[model samples]
Target: MNIFVAGMMMETNSFSAIPCTRDSFVNAMYYRPEHTGPDPEPAAYEQFGYRTFLRLARERGYGAYASLHAFAEPAAPCRQEDYESLRDEILDDLRAAMPVDMVFLMLHGAQMAQGYDDCEGDIIEKVREITGPDIFIGVELDLHGNVTTRMAEASNALVACLLYPHTDFDERGEQLFAIGERFARGEIRTRNHLQRVPMLGLYYTTLPHMMAVNDAVLAAERQDGIHSVSLMHGFAWADHPDVGAAVIVVAESGQGGVPDLARDIGRQFFAARDETRSLRRPVDDILGAIAASPEAGPFVIADVADNAGGGAGADSTFILTRLIERGIKDAALAMIWDPIAVDFAWQAGIGNRLNLRLGGKTGPFAGLPVDGEATVVALADAIEQEDPAGGLMFGIGRAALLRIGGILVAVNSIRQQVYDPVCLTGLGVDLSALRIVVVKSTQHFYERFSTLATGIFYCETPGSLTLDFDAGRYSRLRRPIWPIDADAAPA
Candidate 1:
């Protein structure tokens, strides 16, 4: 059977000031038909999904045709013209390759474009129109996805990663393929039930600890006729009409019992929603914790607010500024995405000290400009390493390393979630040797560093995707959601 596989994946933070252009998407790793080649080491999170699809398709003996996979660094609402141009191109290709039995989409469900509140829904609806409702369509989403009503109505089956650190991309792909095969054989007709929970919170600390959500996921997985279940914590930074936690259940009975299961699970999620509201710590508290910790191992403090994975500018200087202020020596930051600064550093050879104004270039959310003279300790054409969080198969792109003050920052030309030690170790900054290691990421980094770290702290700072949901000026999000209103009831 021929399977058409393609979709755009990027978590657009409506609050971010940066505009996601075609070039931004390309720089983050856009692979077209002919461009698919050897996978890069220290893989970007989304690339893991694309590669998993390719491997499974080949293994299942299905003819796979992929249009293009374009992901941008998380940012503000997508431009209508850019979204249309990209969506139309992919749709045009899918239409030309019609008569395919199934379509597998890889999408970041929280995307908000200028004219579209539900970009995934828009794409699926357009695909449904072309495929005439008979074709089996399957979708795989990030755990942080905002599963909307439109999304539930447009696809045949959908599954999201269960893990917060999202170490389940390949497993989710395998499950999607298994479900697609069942759909193709008419063995199981699945329907989805989606219910929104009244909470806007971060899922960084929820996993490996929260029993309610994990038990729900486990119970749903064990139930008969329940093909798959997902709890999308929803990217809280994304300011859209539908921005809150959601529970999605895919059941085998086409008889429409999915919503019952969905509500049951969603209610359980809602009961525990209040507990998941706040971040692990504010910036000051994080500094205090670091100062109090006596362990020699690197204290990994994640600057969750400015995470690039959640559409925040990775250039935020809040954590870096605090580290510099407290005279925290032997500290390292995996990355700060300032291409211009990186370019300037590249021009200045190793061992040369140069005055640089780094980070805070994106917007006020990224914090103020950090001005300091940094010595170029080491320069490399490219550094390759395996992903720390990715089990056995993921990879990241070429990276460069530079030293600014006591902080050794590994800047990549590519935008990626810093999930592995290689993101720093490849750049000559040994994570084991440092007292503190600050990374610009959300939960994805936890899987890799949990074992090595003496302690892990998620710091609340300012950026597009901040934990301070109440502080954000949201124009379209439906009101009466959690923390936003303590007494708000679930829909």
Candidate 2:
């Protein structure tokens, strides 16, 4: 059996001021097969979901063709020309590798180009046009997306990351391949139903109520004849007609009650909105909680609004400013994406002190740069961090660790969220000694960070990706959804 595999992932936040370019993808990743001509070997894609497909092919001794793997940090819509060039490259590769038994694509279903609202759907539709209906088509998706009907209808199987921190990337990737193998062998016909819930919000799987949703999805998958279940907690910043929570249930063709199961999950999730709302605390609110709580050390505070993974300028100084004002000591903040600061630190040399301005330079929402004399702690020319979202190694280019007052701040040239402690630890910032650790991420940072934190706080703020569902950011979104209407009912 032969399988053609490729991927392009970038989440778009329509409200972000920064535009995503080709360099964004190149800087993050741009991979092609290592060999040329006859027997091409796939590159050593460390920690990518696509690597799972290649691994399966190698272990099973089946033919695999990997082409044009691209990934960029979350930002505004990608340039149309860049999107077309990449999309066409994948199509051309798939055409040249013709007559494959299966087509597997790793995609972030929320990606958007200048003119394309549904990049994932567009790519899948185009792939379907090339591969035809007989070929088993399976997609591995990041659950934070606008789960559109076009994508679900065109592909035979759609498997999304089951967790918000997305620790299940490789697991879901393998699951997709297993389903594809079953379909290709005529063992079972794959039938999927995407049931949309009229609610648009993000949820942390670590929270009790949200964990219940994850448990429910997992339990549903273990039921008879069920192939998979995914709860698509749509990206709130991306404005689209299909932007919201959705339940996708993949069941064996001719299986009964698929729609009912999907509807039941979606409805239950929506009905529990009030309970999940408790996790969505605003910036000052969480800060107040920290001051009042008697809990001793190592509180993991998520700088949610400024999360680069959700298209926020990781340069925001809102939370830092608050912490500084409160004179919070023994705290560490990571990955304020400021290349200038990193460059300045490199020039100043480690163990030296210099007056520097950090972050808040992107847009109005970023607030002002934290200005003060910071002592450089450590520096690295190029560093890589483990990303739990896709089990991938993320490059943090020309990074530096600086201490301002009693706080240790990590600044990196790469625009990304801090996924693992190594992003700081490698640079000599000790996590075990800190009283508070603030990471610029929505939820993907939770998996590993939770272990170190005595408590966790998710703070909503006025930063780029604010959690306010009624923030007037939507124009293209379908009317009457969740907080947008409050009484909007899903039919």
Candidate 3:
């Protein structure tokens, strides 16, 4: 069997001011077909999820051909020329390597280039144009993927990871390959159906699996003829027309229950929409909760609005400023994206004190950059942590740990969500020794930080990815979407 691998991942936030240029991917992550091998190091896997498919093909002795592997940090819609150049590279490769038995595409569903709103759908349609209808095309989508009719109509099958922090990356990779193998061997006829639900909001679907939508997906998958069920949470930060939760049910092609199952799940989501949202509180209110809590030591408060994962600048000082004002001590926060501060700290060297301004550089929402006398306690060229799911290493660039008035703040050069403890522990901050820990993330931090915190609180601060969905401004999105329109339902 011959298998082709290719991927393009970028979670876009239309509200963000950052432009995702070609340099974003080039500087962050970009690889040619020849650059990748069958087995990849953990750090590479964390950066790019494409290695799993390549490894699978190699292990099975199948003809595996890799295309461009590119990933950019979450930001505003990609540049038109930049996205087109990369898209053409992947398509051009597929065109050159014709007559392939199968194709596996790893896509982040919420990509929106300058001129293209449905980037994933556009790529899949182009691939279909090259491969025709005979070849088996399978896709692995992020749960946050904004599933579209174009994508659902073009691909043979689509599988999305069930976890939020994506612990099931390998499992989903194997599942997509399994679907392709079965199709190639004539084991079972499969059909993927997508049912878009008219709902838009931010929510946490972390472990302990409290979300009802997750439970419903599992229940639907257990039913006869259901091969897999995915609740594409839909990236709420992307202001596309199809930006809403979707139910994708895969089952036997001839099975009559697929559509019904899909519709039922969609309805379930609409009925339980309130439960799907995270409980958020104002910064001061959340801080009060932390002070009153009788729980034993360190508590974690998520600065959700400033989560870099959803394209908000991680440098927002809404939470950090308040912590400083409250005179909170023994509290640590990793990473405030302030390269200026980091550079100053680096110049001061370790154990040296310097007065500097940190974070609050973006806008009014970011608050004023805090000014204080800080001591550089720790410095790292880069910080990386192994993902417990498969040892995938997630990391960011140059960082410095600084202590200011008993508060430890991690200053980073790059922007990324704090998904793992290594971001702090690597910078020499003793997480256990602190009374409070603040992470600039919405939900991704749940998997790692929850394990260490005595209690977790979600802060409803102000920034680009703010959870006040109804208050968001959108110029292109069509109206009548849920929450925005009280009587809205899927069209």
Candidate 4:
């Protein structure tokens, strides 16, 4: 059987001011039809989902036609032309690579283009229009997706990662391919049912192993006739019509219990709504908590609001400035997305003391600029790190480590979250020596940072990806969704 693989990965934040351009997608991870093969071990930042699927196709002795694979860091709505150009490129390639038995896609369902609210669904339907009804379509999405009826209807199977930090890309890819293979071999025809629960909030506190939603999904999967189950926690930051929690169940055809199963799972999620509540605290509250604790071990602070993974600028100085003002010692705050600061540091040379204004350059959300004299402790160009999920290398362009008092700041030209420990160690800062470690990430830094720290705290600082979703005035989303309305009824 022939399998066609293509992907467009970007988690769009509707509130963000940054517009995702073609260059943004290209710079992050861009692959064409020419970039194909059985790459069992792709780069850390490479498109692992497509690569894994391609590897599985090779293992199954199937013809795999790989098309445009582009992924940008989470940002605002993609430009209409940029989105269309990339979408068309993939669609055109899929058309040229016709006669494929299956179509496998890697997409972040929360992605929004200028005029397209449901870009994933749009692409899926377009692919369906091209491939016709005969070809089996399977998709792998980030759990943060807003799974719509159209997305479920257009695809044979829609699978999302159970983990929020999304550590199971390869496993999910394999699962998606397996389901698609069942369709190709005429084994079991699958039908998908999506249940959108009226809930809008951050779910950062729940770990993968202990999440009730994941447990409910697992329970559903264990039921007879149920082939797959996924709970899209939903990107709360997005302001689209379908911007809320969702449950998707893929069951064997003729399975009448699928809808109930999907609803049951959604109900379970809604019942345990508190589990998904954000555990973000103000900076002062975090500091107080730290003072109350007796543990002298490293504390990993999650600067959630500034997380680049959630479309924040990743250059916010709110937490860093507070730490500095409070005279916090032996702490390292990383990956402040400041291109000018990095350039200035490079020009000043390493080991040289220079007066520099750092961070807060991305406008109001990033906080006021902090001006101070600091020593350039370390400098490195083309700094790259392995993404904890797949060990794929992502470049953090020209980096500099600036030391202000006892605080060490990791400044980079590239706008990226400090998802990995390498973002710090790559700059020659010994994380072991630090008393506190601040990462500009929401939850992606959990797996790595958790291992090194004695305590971890997620802070609700002022920035683009704020945990206080209710405060934002969203004109697109419908009324009565969870805490936003307080008395909202669950769907």
Candidate 5:
């Protein structure tokens, strides 16, 4: 049996000013099938379950038809033409690969295009329209997705990554394929329901409360009829009516308590969010922790508000300026979005000194520019960083290592969060030698970074993707949600 496979990964941030354009899609990746087109153009990312699915297809003795795979980082609503064009590309591929037993997709559930509120839903719905419901459809999504009504209606199985660092995409990919196989054979009919928890908060799986919730999900899966239970922590940056936490329970058709269990877990998750709130600290407090530390190892500070992954400008100078003000020298802040500075450094070459204006170029919330006479320490055309998505390598284009006083900063032509130590190490900045390391990210940087740093700090500042889940920050949240409105109803 032949199974069709396609992927389009783009997470939209309704609050962002930048629009995700056609070039953005191409810059990330635009991989067409080898059979249809001349050599496909490669991008920095999109290695999601590529190897696993190949292994699975061989193991199951099934032929898998390849389609286009593309990924753009989180930004504002995608351009209408770009979304439609890419959607058409996948649809066209599916049409050509007819008589397929099943379909598998890799998608960012929160993808929103202009005039279309639910891009993932529209893709699935269109695929279903073409396949006529008989072809089993299975989807694997990032945990940070808006599990909408349309998506649940279109697909047979929708499973999200259980971990926040999203290190489990390969595992989840296998799970999706397994479900899709069972669905194709008509062995068991699935019953799925999405119960929206009326709240928006950052809850990482590493935390105790979320850990317990994940544990419960694991326990629930151990039951006879339940297939999967995933708490889709809706993307907070996306300003939509469906922008809140939700629990989706996919179970057998005859399962009795699936709906009840989903609702119960949703309520429990909302209640447990308060415990997750204490994880972040003020910049000053984090600095205090650094000063009070007895260990010499690098203290990793995660600049959460300015996380590029959540659609924030990656060039925030709030923490960088603070560290400079405190006269902290043995530090390295990485992947600051400054293309002009990088080009200047490239011209000057390594070990050469040049005056440069860095960061704060995106917006006001990005803070003021850090101006200094910086010495060029290192320069690389592209520094590759291993993504948590199964060790997939992503390049930080035209990277330059600038030493402004005691701090060695990692400036990138590509606007991206630091996923691995290679973001620094590739630029010749040693992790063990540095006293402080600031990564423009929230939770995604924890997996590889945790082993090297003495401790990790999630630093909150005034910028895009703020932790404060109030209605003032998000004006268009359709329903009353927690912290925003006290009386919002859950489930």
Candidate 6:
């Protein structure tokens, strides 16, 4: 069967000041063959979902045609022109390649365009109009996907990664394709049932270390006729009307079975909602733990509030500022995404001592740029490396190592989430000798660093996607949710 695969993904943070444009996508990650070369395909960390989907579909003996796949680091809502042009380009390609048996999409479910709040839903609806209702459509989404009713009604079948800090992209892609293959053979008539929890939150609830949501996911996986079960923690940054956590169950038939399974899972999710809300430690508590630890091994401190994966500007220097204040030496922060700083460092060359202002360039929430004298340690144009902690592959764009005061910072031109040590060691930064390693990511960093770290702490700070949702100046989110009201009854 002929299958068409294409994707456009970008998580929107409504609160962010950064406007996502075509140039932003290009600067962050532009993989056009004409621009790069014939052999070296445009590759970036954000395209992980799309690449895996195409790879799995080709392996399943289907004639897979990947038209185009484009993604950028999480940022503010996309511009109207940029969104329409990209959407039309993908749809235009799909129309030309019509008569395909199936279409698989990789989407960041929380995307908000200038004129469109439900862009993914709109794309799916438009694609449905082109392919018609009978044509099978499948989607692979991040666990942070906002599984809106509009999205649920438009797509034929959908699957989301179960793990937070998501290491299950490939696994979920395989599952989605398997379901598509089953549909092609007429083996299973798939139906999906989705239920949204009242509260809106981040990745704290989805952690395996946290029992409530984790056990519920495990239980749903055991249910019969349930091909796949996903718990979308939902993207908390997008201030759309459909912002909240959700449970989706894909069953064998498009009937009562899926709904029943979904309800079972939804109830459990609601029952445990309290336990899942806002799990984090204060900055002081995290620092105390680090000071108490005796192991010489590097400890990982997660700056969740400034996680780029959650649409926060990776340039936030709150954690870095505090590190410098504490006089913490022998530590590394793999990365602070600033093209200007990287360019300045590049011009300075390796071993050159220079004064530079790093990070805090995004906005006030990101704090002010730290001005200090730093020594250039190492420099590299491209680093093809795997996450030392999780084994996930990532491409680090033009990067440089600079030692500022007591801390070592790896500055990259590209904005990305640093999940593993390879992002550092790949560029000649030693991971074994450092006392602490600060990662500007949420839970995805856990998969790789949890075992290696003597201590892992999530630092509460200030940024667009801060874990302190209650403290955020939100204008749109539906209220009475947990933590927002301690006395309010659970969903």
lDDT of each: 0.75, 0.85, 0.81, 0.83, 0.83, 0.74
Give the clash count for model 2: 0
Runs in model 3 lying further than 4 Å from the true structure: 35-47, 207-212, 276-278, 387-391, 470-472, 489-491
lDDT of 4 by residue, 304-330 (tens): 889888898888889988898999998
Write out the backbone clash pairs for model 2. Answer: none
Candidate 5 structure lDDT: 0.83
Cα deviation at 472, candidate 3, in Å, is 5.7
Better of 4 and 6 by TM-score: 4
> For model 2, how does the per-residue alpha-carbon lDDT over 1-491 read when each residue is reduced to its tens digit?
99888999999998888789998898888887764112346454454568888888778878887877899989999999999999999999999888899999999989999999999999999999999989999999988878899999999999998877787788898888999999999999987798988887777676677788878988999998899999888888888798888889999988999988988898777876656456768667877777788877688888888988888889999889888888889989988999999999999998999999999999988998889999999998668888876667888888999988888899999888888888878888777787788999877787788888888887877888775665466778887887778678766
In order of listing, the candidates' clash counts read: 7, 0, 0, 6, 0, 4
Choose the strongest candidate by lDDT: 2
| TM-score, every prediction | 0.89, 0.94, 0.93, 0.95, 0.95, 0.88
Better of 3 and 6 by lDDT: 3
Poorly placed runs, candidate 1 (over 4 Å):
34-48, 51-54, 205-211, 253-257, 274-279, 384-405, 411-415
Error of 3 at 77 (Å): 1.0
Model 1 residue pairs with clashes: 41-395, 41-396, 42-395, 42-396, 43-395, 43-396, 74-311
Show the lowest summed lDDT stretch of 10 residues, model 3.
35-44
Per-residue lDDT of model 3, residues 189-232, tens digit only:
78788888877775456533336777988888777777788888
The C-alpha stretches of model 5 lying farther than 4 A from their native spots are 36-51
Candidates by lDDT, descending order = 2, 4, 5, 3, 1, 6
What TM-score does model 1 achieve against the real structure?
0.89
For model 1, residues 370-441, the per-residue Cα lDDT tens digits are: 899888776655555444323532234434566766778776655556777777876677788898898888
Worst 10 residues of 6 by lDDT: 33-42
